[model samples]
Target: MSGNGWLRPKKSRQKLRKRGLDNPGDLTTISSRSSIKNGPGVSVDKDLPPLPPVAPLQAHRLKYKEAHSRIDTQRGENRDYTALIHALGLEDPFDDDESWPRRERDEEGERPPGEPVVASLPSHLWTQIAGYLNPKDAVCLALASRTLYARLGKAPFEALRRPENASHKLALLLTLDRYLPRHLLCFPCGKYHLRSQPGCEKLQPSDALVRNPVFVCPNARNMLRRAPRHRIAHGWSLPFSLVQLATRAARFGPHYGVDVDALARRWKGKSGDSEDGWSHSTRFLIHDGRLLMRVVSQCFAPPNLSPSGQRLLLFSRDDYFPYFSVCAHWRDGELTQVCKCALTHVPEELPRGPQSIEAKFKNSLLMGPRRPTAATAPTLCGFCQPMRRCPKCPTEYLIEIKLSEVRNHHHRGGVEFRHALVVTRWSDLGDGSAPSTSLEWAACNGDQAGAGYDSFSRLGKRAISGIFEAKISSDNTGIPGRRIMSMNPGNVKGGDDWY
Candidate 1:
C-alpha cells in the first residue's frame, strides 16, 4: 500500500482503480445495453426527438401572457357593448315605465350619444360622509352654508347636541355669538338690549353700528350657550353690599384686608349703568377658627333646617389642632377644650371629665378606643349622656373605633379590638332631635390587625383602662337607682356628635 505512491497520487489512483473495477466495460456498450433493456426507449442518437412540433402563434401567445387582466370599461371605445345595453334599455327594467327613458328617446329619434346618466346618492350615504368631518367643519359644510349644510340632514346637528358630545356644545357656544338676540347675552337682560338695540342712545356713539347690525364676537357669543334647555323663570342679581362683602373677604382675611370702595367701583363699571345690577361671588374664608364675617343664614339655600330655621354644620377639632377637641359657642364667646383622645395612639383609654364643671373647663368627653374593630361587641358603644347638661358629662361627644386581632394560643382565632370615641356635638340641637353619627372603626385580622378577640373576652382581661359614665336617666332617678356604667369592649365605635 505504501509503494503505489511513486506512480500516481496514492488516493487518486485508488479511486480510479475502484471506478474501473465497477465499470469493467466500454462506455458506448453501456448505453446500447440500457436501450435494449428499457422496452421501446429512444436512443440519444435517434434524430434528436423531432424538435417539438411548432405551435400556432395565438395559442402560444395566450399561454405566455400574465394571469391578471385590467379592463377599462368607461364610456365610449366599445360600440358593440354600448349597442347591447341600448337594446336592453328599450324595455323598462325597474318598473312598468317602458317608455320613460325609451319614450323620451323615442320622441327624439334616438338619445344623444356620450351623455352620462347622473346617479343620486341615498340619504344614509350622505350622513355617513358627513359624520367623518369635525364639528366645526361639519357645521361649516352641513349647516353654515345652506346649499351644503341642508343636504346633510338634521341628524348630524342632533347628534352634536348630545351631552356626551362636548364638541357639539363647543360648536353651539361658538355659533351662538353670531346669532343670539341681545337680551339673551346680558346677565340682567336690560343692559344687553340697550347696548345692542338699534337707535338706542347708549349705542349712539357707534352711529354706523346702528345703521348696520354688527355680529357679536365669537368669544362673547359662546358664553351664552348652555344645554338641558330650561328657562330661568326668575333670577335675582346680588346687591352691591353682598358683592362687596364677598370680594373684600376674599381679598382680605384676619391677616390682611383689601380696599373695599375701590373694589366696589371696579365692579360697578363692569355692570354698566342700569337699575338691575350684576354681582359675582367668588370666595369665603374662615379666620383663626371662626367665620371672620357673617353671611346671611340663607347664603346657601338649606335643604334641611330645624323648626327655628337653624341649619347645622359639623367640623372636627383635628382640623385645627392635633389632639381631640372642637371649638364650640358657649353662652356667648367661643371656647376650645380637650374633648377626646388624640388619634395617634391605638388601644387608648377614653378622656377624663371634671367633678364640678368649671366656667371655662367642661367635663372630659369619652375618647373610646382608637382601634375600631374589637374582640367583643357592646350594645351601648353608641349610647350618649341621657341628660342635656351635667357637671360630669360633656354635652357633645365623638367615638371612633378600629378593630385589630392579637395572637393568643388559648383561642383558636385571635380577637379584634375596637377603637371608639365619644366627643361633643359640633352643632347645636334645639331640644329632642337626634344627632348625626359617624364611626372610624376598622376590622383587622390577627395577622394584620395586630390582636385577637380573646384579648378582652373575660372581665379584667383588657389591660387598657378608661373612665366612662352614662347620664342619670329620669327612670333611674324616679326609682332612686344609680347610673349604669360600661366600657367599649372593642374600639369599634368611632366619630363625634353632629348638631
Candidate 2:
C-alpha cells in the first residue's frame, strides 16, 4: 500500500499550466460528494440523507469551482463566522423563538457579589425610578414591566390637574381611568368653599378618606384623623374656569384623558391660589336658589357638585362656549367629579346636535330661595290672607344676567352682559323652553316658580306680568293684598339707564 498524504488531481501539471489554472481554480479539484467527507456535499441522489443545512456563509461559494472544494471552503468559513456570532450572542436567524438572553441578569452572573443588586430589586423600586423619568422614558419602562405598568396607572394624572397647569388638567380629565378598580379614581382636594345650606352636614369619616400616615399631603393626615362628618346641601360653587375647558377639548379631542400625573398634581400641588396670582375663580350669585358661574379662562379647577343622579351630562365647549349642568337628582348625592370633558374655545356656530345637549337638572329652579308664601289660591267666596311679613312669606329676590361675545355686531369686544330678574313662578311661558326654567332651577322650586323676564319693560307691564306670573304659577297673588308692581320705569329712561 504505497500511500500519499494528499491526493492530486489526475490532470498533469503541464496541462493545467497550459490552461492557466491555479490551485484554487475550478478544474484543479475533485468533484465527487464522497471527496468532501470534512464538509457539506452536493448530494447526487434525491434519497441520500439530506446534506447538513447550508451554512449562511456558504452563500458566497463559487458555482464554477469543484463542488467538493466549494463545500469544504464554505464549511470552514461558516464555522468561523458562526463562532464569532455566537460569542456576540446575536440572534439565530432561523430560530422561531426570538428570545434573547436577559442582559441584566446575564451580566449580573458574570460579576462578583457585592457589586450591586440592581438586577434583582423588586419591580416596585424600578417603578419609583420610572416615576422620576421623563414621560417618554417612563412609558418605555412601563411597557417593559407588568408591575411597573400597574403602578404607573394614571401616574401622570397629578401633573395635569393643578390650577395653573389647566392645559394638562384638561388632558387628564378627558381620560378614563380604565386601570383603576372602580373605573373611578377620585382625587379629593383638601379645602374648598361652598354656599351654605343651613341644615346640611359634612360627610362622615367612613364616607370620605381616612388620614394615612404615609400620605404625602399634610392636610390629608389631619382630615383623616378628624373623621369629619357633616350634612351637605349647599355652600360654595366649585372652582372651574373657561381656560381649563378649552384646553381639555384640544388635548383629548375624541380620546380618553385619564392620567395619574394630572390627578396627583391637582391633588398635591396646584390649587386656586397658585403662583400665577390670577384670580381664576369667582363667587356667583344665588338667584332663586340656583348657583350661576361662567367659565372664562384657560386654567381653572374643576367645579364641585353633589352626585344625586345616575348619569351626569357634562357639556364641554358648547356652541364654542363651555357650559355644563347636571342631570335629574344628581345633586342628591355627595359631591364628586364624574366624567371629564375637554374644554375648547367657543366655536363660531355652537353645535346644536345631540353632542351639545346635556341632561338638565330636574326638580330644580335656576334661582330663588325656598320659603312659604301668604296669599293662597283665591278661595272661592271666602278668604283669610296670611300676614305678608310673616316668616312664611316667601322672600322674592331678583338677579340680572347679560352676555355678549368678544366681538359682536354692536362692536362690543370681550364678553358683554345684559340683565334679567329672578322672578318667582308667575306664568307659563308658552312651551317649557324658557332658559330660566331649566331643570337646574327646577330643583329649587320645580313648576311652582314662574318664568323670568328680561330686565326691560314698562313699570305697569312689569308689575302686571309679575303679578300674573306669581298668581298663576305659585297659586298666590300679590304681597298681602298689595297689587303686583311693574319694572322700574327709571331703568328704561335712556340708553345709559338701561340695565
lDDT of 2: 0.27
Clash counts per candidate, in order, are 62, 92
Number of the top-ranking candidate, with TM-score as the measure: 1
191-225 in candidate 2: lDDT tens per residue?
A: 22221221112122222323211123334445453
- Using alpha carbons, what is the TM-score of model 1? 0.18
List, residue by residue over 64-120, the lDDT tens digit for candidate 1.
443212223464344455556776777756445565677676568665532121115
Evaluated at residue 474, the lDDT of candidate 1 is: 35
What lDDT is reached at residue 74 by model 2? 42
Q: Which stretches of candidate 1 lie over 4 Å from their true place?
A: 1-126, 134-137, 161-167, 178-499
